[model samples]
Target chain A: MPHDSAGHTPIDMPDDPDARIIRALKALLIGRGFFSADDVRRKIEELQSPAPARGAALVAAAWSDPAFRAHLLADGKVAAAERGVPVLEAGLIVVENTPSLHNLITCTLCSCYPRSLLGQPPPWYTSKAYRARSVRDPRGVLAELGWTPPRGIAIRVHDSTADMRYLVLPRRPDGTEGWPEGDLARLVTRDSMIGVAPALSPSAVGRDPSGI
Target chain B: MDRLRFAIGQRVRIRDLPVPGHMRTPRYVRGRTGEVTQYCGSFRNPETLAYGGNGMPTRGLYRVRLRQGDLWSGYRGSGQDTLEIEIYEHWLAEVGKGAPDAP
Candidate 1:
């Protein structure tokens, strides 16, 4: 295998425009005083390490503990930081789902997600179609996403338009009495925390080989 | 004392005025009436923050709710359904209170 200057085998990229552009940009930035290679690598590593699991753990903890829930509701940024979840400088506002109101999140202008907590956003979330329809019709969008709240419950859509980030504090499902926090965390999915769907229910959590 | 003009539960309308550069308020809710849900504290204006200028002028942030029927034409959802947006103080005005003026 022929290795490039970095001594790593060159990956397949005959016509990848972005790959070339990114490589050139990195070289230019490092050549100039804009950013060092280490800085870029550090940022990529940090982003890759963080995922929805962190948010799920927080939600699970909140479900079991009242005091932590109170603190989280009082000040989301502080609570997440206190629990060691690197609260991004961009403010995070946690909204709780209640029997009366259901919350839906969408970024109408752009694809600004809670990357600091959730590892990555699905492609559909950032698409223009979802961005437009979510604001125009939230209930229709929710049903398509497999989130069907009991009839007569109101849906509230939150458009993250600015520097602020939001995390949905999904209501705990019933019949989960005394479930261990670790097990409960499994019930939470990335989309559930994003308010696109409700947290996984006990009835739907079937045993798998990996014990999801 | 906080410099906020509207209190929680107050009925207000999102202004129809166009904003320069970037804006947090979506177009669908413009000129629509809604109730203030909660105060999200004062923060540097994002419109200015996006540009190179210093985002010095802080504005009160809020979570406002509007009925789904009010925004969408021929809406099928129950009248109880509502949509909430995080809007700045400058983009809202007191409505249904004696010829309310724009902010």
Candidate 2:
């Protein structure tokens, strides 16, 4: 499990040529004058591990408890801290997804994400197209991500800066009442937290015919 | 640049700085009206004109709120839905407060 500065684990990436290049650079830099590349490499490695499943439990609890949901929305960092999610002091804002409103976040300038909660950002998120089009045409971006908000729903696009990170708290899906936290965690994908996708219900999971 | 300060509900305009490479300031908000909703502290300006300009170490950060109606006049959605964005100090200026007229 890769651990970041905040002690949160990130998802692992498949080893590829790019990964090799990163490793080589780490070795080259550490072998020279730059500060211990090994330390940096270790931190990066920790960031690549799958994030702890603890956050899932909080989401699940919020799904079943309206009070908790309100608390989560009122002060997400505090609520998550109570749940042991290790909310970093990076000036993060938790935007809630409601039936009438949808929120999408992008770092037009750079990739400033809530790594402590959602783990590493997906590849599609770092794409130039996603960044450029997110603010200009958010509805189109959401559509491309397979989310079509109901008519009359407003979509707000937030561009994260270098200092502030943003996270989207997706609305609790239907047919999830009485579901256990362990079962609910499986439904929360990183994309949902970014507002590019919605949380999956049991029926939707593994229901894709293409095996995606 | 020094640390920037502003309060919630204070309207400000984003500056159009000529920065090379990619920057966090979206082009759309370059000269748009936004209000400071949250105060984010200082941090390294990622857009560090790497090619050689100023070697500043840190920049101020703040979260500004832009109403959908303000951003898009034809925006047909709820007026309460506002987009909050984080911006560096160098990217903002007092609204209607023109830059000093060059002598």
Top of the candidates by lDDT:
1
Q: lDDT by residue for model 1 over A1-212, one digit each (tens)?
A: 76457866768766588888989999998999899999999988977777799899889988999999888887888898888987775788887888887778889989878887888788999999999988787778888877667767777778887657888989887767788899888888888878889887877786332333
lDDT of 1 at A150: 74
lDDT digits (tens) for residues B2-98 of candidate 2: 4357666788887777775756777777778888876666776667645464537677787788886777667655566567788887777888996
TM-score for the A chain of candidate 1: 0.83
> Chain A TM-scores, all candidates?
0.83, 0.76
lDDT tens digits, residues A1-212, model 2?
Answer: 76456866767976899998987887888888686966787887878663735456667777767798788777777788887776674755678888888888888776778778777877878889998878766777777778777767778788886666677777887776666667777788777888888888678765322232
Q: What TM-score does structure 2 among the candidates reach? A: 0.73
Q: Which candidate leads in DockQ?
A: 1
| Poorest lDDT segment (10 consecutive residues) of candidate 2 chain A | A203-212
Query: In candidate 1, which residue pairs get closer than 3 Å at backbone N, Cα or C atoms, i.e. clash?
Result: none
Error of 2 at A24 (Å): 6.9
Leading candidate by TM-score: 1
